[model samples]
Target: MTSTSARVGGIRKEVDAQKLGPALLIASSLVLAIRTARWPATSDEGLANVEWQKEVEHSGHIAKAMLSHLISRYPSLFLLKDVPWYVPTDEDVPE
Candidate 1:
């Protein structure tokens, strides 16, 4: 009986760990959308800025992380060879 309960508890923990990351990711995204929905959607510049910020936030994080990893492995390619690293849909460097 104790072994059966332990096995169930272990499975429960594994399932919880696997689910928690995605659950947190989705929850945070929903919370962000709810909070930012208050912004005025009228002006052209304001809307554009919001879109741009979203792009920068999402793309920039992914791009920078990838670039940093590549740089770590192949420093010569970036530093000495002058290879231009490009990120997807990245027009300009994020500030």
Candidate 2:
């Protein structure tokens, strides 16, 4: 009984250790990303993105622009949502 309990405790500790590393890494990365976004560099593209983010924020169009950026980044995102070239008929899926 003692040996089994000890092994189980060790396994639990190992899993907990694994979780801690990933959580720490993700938190640190998010912090760095926010800092970089809040203070963009002098590069033209970086400055442009920063300005766009600012303008969207000020104009209250942030959601629309953010959505557009996401869609543009993945041109094929709406491919699956698009209607087929051929018109659908009752034969396609009988009611």
TM-score between candidate 1 and the true structure = 0.32
Model 1 C-alpha RMSD vs. true structure (Å) is 21.4
The TM-score leader among the candidates is 1
The residue-level lDDT of candidate 2 at 61 comes to 44
Candidate 2 has an lDDT of: 0.43
lDDT of candidate 2 at residue 92, scale 0 to 100: 53
Q: lDDT per residue, candidate 1, 1-95, as tens digits?
A: 11221111121111222333444455446555665677666657544576647844675455555555655675543324222333333233354
> 4-95, model 2: which lDDT tens digit per residue?
22112121111222233444444445544554576655657544576556654543343344435645675443332322244344455465
* Model 1 pairs in collision: none
| Clash count for each candidate, listed in order shown | 0, 0
Query: Which RMSD values do the candidates have, in order?
Result: 21.4, 20.2
Worst 10 residues of 2 by lDDT: 5-14
